[model samples]
Target: MQRVRVLVIDDSALVRKLLSTMLACDPAIEVVGVAADPLIAREKIKQLEPDVLTLDVEMPRMDGLTFLENLMRLRPMPVVMVSSLTQQGAEVTLRALELGAVDFFTKPSNDLASTFAAGAQEICAKVKLAALTRPRVRTIVRKLEVAPRLSADAVLPRAQTPDSRGGSRIIAIGASTGGTEAIRVVLEAMPPDAPPILITQHIPAAFSGPFAARMDNCSAMRVCEARDGQPIQHGHAYIAPGSQHLLAMWDGARYVCRLHDGPPVNRHKPSVDVLFRSVAATVGAPAIGALLTGMGDDGARGLAEMREGGAMTLVQDEASSVVWGMPGAAWKLGAASEMLPLDHIAARLLELARQPIARAMRAVT
Candidate 1:
């Protein structure tokens, strides 16, 4: 098998060296070259024709976003952004993803050497996954080896029985990898009066707030990071905070968001499984669950739980996903009641939301 060739582009020599060394440590990857800025990168890209790129968020001659925009417009290829763990970095990295970058990772604020070493596995895994994805296109369906990880049960116990309380229907969504953009697509199309949406997207603590803010700007529904004990209401979308697990709980009369500071489940702090299981237990048949694009199987079991609890479950079709790991796993497990393209998910959710609770419950039965 051919090794993935990667070009390291960063303004800092230390970053370039560290990124190249970490990536090279993986036998499946080869560091083709390094560039100090986008200008140098442009030349090297034409010369080396590497399979993937690790670009720094801020560069000297040209910024990463600008370079990414130009590259996608002309010659598109898989690019993973390397950014700082800061507010500014989060905003820039999100822009990079919008410009067709495959994924991103935050650089440590301090202890560069040790931090980089510690994240070597994650860094390599992202690059390798990016290589399998088409630039500015949907992700190729594939699976990667996940490290030993805890299940949603580690954070919250499985509900003994599905909760069938009388309340407004809610929507639950989970995504990773290429999810940020894919999520933007869904939110933009939703109506202002859409059902309450609970989302769990794999992100860093610094990025989730900015991500929610960005989505709020584009979505008619009010979008915000989920708060502990916050009431879930119509026309609002609650995003799971990057540092905590967000769950739905029946608060006597209405559903409310509950944030848990528990161990990471399925290697994610805001595990989709944790959120889905909670919805299955609390919202039951009236709840609608959709598993979007992601790299791993975190949400598969949770979505199945939702289906078993008589909730309508959907999975994004592989053709529209950047990585089909999560949704594909759900479909294979027979968790999804329907598989739809990215464009159709919002409409289906709204249509399902309009159904009488009894009818919606009957469809799953």
Candidate 2:
């Protein structure tokens, strides 16, 4: 197998060296070159022609976002961002994902060397996955302009009715690679009355808050990072906090969000398996499970469990996935009752959300 060639770009020589050294530890990865800023990166890109790039969010002469935008337009390739563990860094990292970065890693707030050492495996793994990703060519950054907030009832007219209420209906979604934009597309297209959504996307703790905030700003549905004991509500979506696994549990009458600090499942802290299995056990047939674009099989068995538990299951078709590993695994297990394209998922979910529990179950399979 050909080793993946990577270019390291950071204003800090220490960061550049650290990144280069960390990536080189993997025999399958080669540090082809290093650049201090976007200007140098641009030139190195031409000369080295690397397979993947590790970029810094804040760099002298040219910021990472602008450089990524230009790179995607002129010479599209895989990129993984190295971001600071700050609010500002989180915002920029999300923007980089929107602009075409395959993924990002957050630098710890204290003890940089120790943190980097601990996260080296993750860094190398992401680089390998990014190398396999197909880069999309978007000439301009996708605008995430804020939209007017709509009440839950605005989309789901019967949402407030006692009979049409909470515990009986639920939606669980999971995604990883290229998930930031994929999730936004789904949420933006959903109706106001859509059932409460539970999401577990692979991301660091520092970025989850900003990711939720960005989702809230652009989506009609109220989006926020999940807190332990928060009740699930209609017209809102709860994203699993970074470093925690989010599970849905029934408290006699209604379902509520629960956070767990269990060891990483499938090598992901907020593993999709944990969330899906919890929903299968709690919500049963009334639940709808959708596995979007991701790079591993974390959610496959859990999604299959959801299906066996009588839930309607959907998997994003390979044609639309950034990396079809997770969804493909589920589909192979006969976990998904429906295989749909990305654009159709939101509308299908809304249609299912409006149906009576019995009818929703009958409509699938």
* Cα-based lDDT for every prediction: 0.89, 0.87
Clashes of 2: 3
Please give, for residues 91-191, the per-residue lDDT of candidate 1 as tens digits: 98887887789999789989899999999999999999999986764222222222344558899998775453645699999999989988888888877
Model 1: residues with Cα > 4 Å off, grouped in runs: 137-164, 363-365
**Mind giving the per-residue lDDT tens digits that candidate 2 earns over 1-365?**
99999999989887888888899999999999999999999999999999999999778888889999999888899999998878898899898998889888887767878789889999999999999988865322233343456666777776343642323779999998888877887887765656899999998888899999998987778999999989998889999999999999866656789999999999999999999999998888889999999998989999999998888899999987878999999999999989998778887887776678886456444
Candidate number with greatest TM-score? 1
Colliding pairs, model 1: 139-322
Angstrom error of the Cα, residue 199, model 2: value is 0.8
How high is each candidate's TM-score?
0.90, 0.88
